[model samples]
Target: MTRARRALIDLSSTSYYHLIARCVRRAFLCGDDKYTGKNFDHRRRWLVERIKLLSSVFAIEIAAYAIMSNHYHLVVKVNRQQALKWSNNEVICRWYKLYRGTPIIDRYLRGEELIEEEQLLVTELIEKWRARLFDISWYMKNLNEFIAKRANKEDGCTGKYWEGRYKSQALLDDAALLSCMAYVDLNPIRANMANKLEDSDFTSIQERIKQLQSNNVYVKSEITHQVKQPKSLKPFGIRDHARTLPFSLLDYLKLVEWTGHHIHTEKNRHILKGTPNILKLLKIGGATWLEVIKNYSNHYGHFVGSKTVLRAHAAKNDVSWYKGVG
Candidate 1:
């Protein structure tokens, strides 16, 4: 049965989530079409650019992503606290970037006084928009809808472009987060589209590698302040006063590289390579970690975590049971 998104997503349980959306009928809509012999690789660029653009406007941060031919994966962290801290004007300014506001809002921005009722309405609208700024549903909706419209126009047809509502799974612990990120980053290699991490185009791992190699710093025209890390993707490092992934960036890169090697080897042959140190820190057996990343979708439903954490979340949500408990 299809459950309501609210029932599935509990922010108090966790802020990080793994999301997936597929092309309609599992067609090669974003890659080279084998049936028609036409290339649609440009569509992948469209999705990547839109994802980054929305991340800047919304309070969501992109932790990892991979754009495949028929589907895409995203591991994002919803920064609700950041959204709450935005002033009313700042909220409106951010909202205006994606949508046009009412005349009252324009006048308000122009320094013209609004009537008491108009001011109240403005307050109500701002509150609603503020909530949406950090909402995953709204973020994905904006992303999928924009691409659907543009792709439809180019294809000269008017119908559904996406399969359905994007699927989401809450990451209840560091184990789940780490495993899911590796799974997403290694998608191309698993699918046999790329043999190595560097060849994994349109994947966050590739982008991070390129940025590090070239010593590039992303700057946005609208952002007045400077950020030391890549602006589009979240920074990976030990958690401290500033928000970041719970692992070091170099360690993560090594982990991904190590995992990619194992993935390429024949299944029956056991390679004598040692596991990356990050796996030891996370307390995950390297063989177990490889299985989880290889079959991530089969292991979990709406929530992914240890058996204890999954049971607790299920009880809190008033459900009899949850998947991925084993």
Candidate 2:
């Protein structure tokens, strides 16, 4: 059956996603070419920094990622609960960091002097940015467009650098989330780009490793169960100083490292046979465990296709087109 690029995702249903974006030309969009020999390592850094910066603006928390020669992967959790809590003005204030809006927007977001009319305008503008912040399409568009413009200027070329559209998979549960994260972190090992996850350059795994060692990480040690959850189904807190379960922060980091080693190589493949232990760590039922493992096939861009039924989606994902249709 034919399918559109993306089926509509019930945003409220899932707060986490696995997103992938690839270059237009499959050849050397990211690596050093043997023929022309142009390098794009800087471009990879551009993406990483941009990802990190965007996280600061939006309520996105990046769990894992890998940037390859022609493509990149991201395992991000959208804090919809937190994002929805922000006042309309707070949303605009944050978005204006990545994008430049209008003159009134600058004054409003910056806390500068404003006319009574400007105050009213700011109120209305914030409403718009607030709405767009939760929409993944808007999030991706903002990220892609910024990078594309900068990249085009640097390469002295114009037109599309990205493929048709970015792809995303909603993680049905924790198994899907952790496994996909491992898949992303192990991308370098699978491609022979790096012998181990620790050495993978320009990857979140590497950045995270550095952060872990240097103690630059912002991950809170308090588990959600211990700390008080916000009163709202949507959290009233913008950034919670709490962590997920299995409180030993030290143990969790070790587990993440061990997971990286598990799928990294042929000779070391046997080291990951502690099925019961692994399952226990991720906290999943055996049936759910097997189902998630089955989804990790080679057919669909290194991970299973998303649950989104593409049939009900639009023909294209262009923002203007979507607005017109709506």
Candidate 3:
């Protein structure tokens, strides 16, 4: 049966999502033609920086991301409670920062003289803008538009640079969410872009690793996470270490590392080719990792490793995701 189209995403129901956006040209933006070029290296840095900057402005959180040549993927969890509580004026104020102000907006902020009725109209307009500010469409619109313009300028061209709309998938369960994330992080490996997740440039995993290593922060699997994670860990992969949020930054990082390593193992290679290995590993049903272990080894390895190494690799995944987005 055909599936019903999703009504507008209800931020209230769930903030987490797996989003994918691709460029218009078949293979123009990425791969050997892209990420490696001297001119475009900054583009990789651009994506990570933009994600860090934008996530601050919006109530969205990025969990996992992989910036490939032709396309990009992001897993985000929206902070619905925070967004819903924003005052109209606060929302409008934030929205203004993303785009240039119009005459009406400037006049309002400047406290210039205006009729009582005119003030009311402006109030309504701002309310609308505020609502848009919290919406994903607005976030993606600004993100995409800004990059497109920058890319166009760099290429010395002026025209539609991206496709019409981005594609989105609902991560219905932890299995789906986790699998998608692993898929994103494994992008470079699958494409032969990098030998391992750590070497994958411009990814969120890499960023997380660097931060953890530089400082005394927990950035590994559950076996390693002794404390909670920040809110940014919720699906928004990027965040300043200073900020705090729900969940153990430590434990969450641990989980991703555990799942990720399993995904990259030789036996799981078939999954990259669309086999059911991922399903089994997550144990949706008959789907279980134990079976793979039996087939690939004598018994299930079941997350046996060093926390530091595991975390380092996972952080590398995060960093690469952010870096590659450009």
Q: Quantify all predictions' global Cα lDDT against the true fold.
A: 0.87, 0.61, 0.57
| Candidate 3, 1-326: lDDT as tens digits | 22232432544334556676778854355444543343455666666667767787888778877787767778776666677688766777777667776787778778899898878888888777766656777778877888788888887788876776765554434444454555566667666677655688877676666656556653443323333233344423222332332334443444445544555574745333322333444444322432332232121111111233324433543422211111
Candidate 1 is scored at a TM of 0.94
Model 1 lDDT, full chain set: 0.87
Q: Scored by Cα lDDT, where does model 3 land?
A: 0.57
Worst 10 residues of 2 by lDDT: 230-239
lDDT of 2 at 46: 84
lDDT-superior candidate, 2 or 3: 2
Ranking by lDDT: 1, 2, 3
TM-score for each predicted model, relative to the true structure: 0.94, 0.71, 0.68
Q: Which candidate is the best by TM-score?
A: 1
Per model, how many backbone clashes are there? Answer: 0, 0, 44
The lDDT, on a scale of 0 to 1, for candidate 2 is 0.61
Residue 128 lDDT in candidate 1: 97
Report the C-alpha lDDT of model 2 over 185-257, residue by residue, as the tens digit: 6678667788755688876656655554455443324332223321111111212333342123333344445
Worst 10 contiguous positions by lDDT, candidate 1: 218-227
Model 2, which residues run further than 4 Å from truth? 1-7, 103-122, 215-278, 281-326
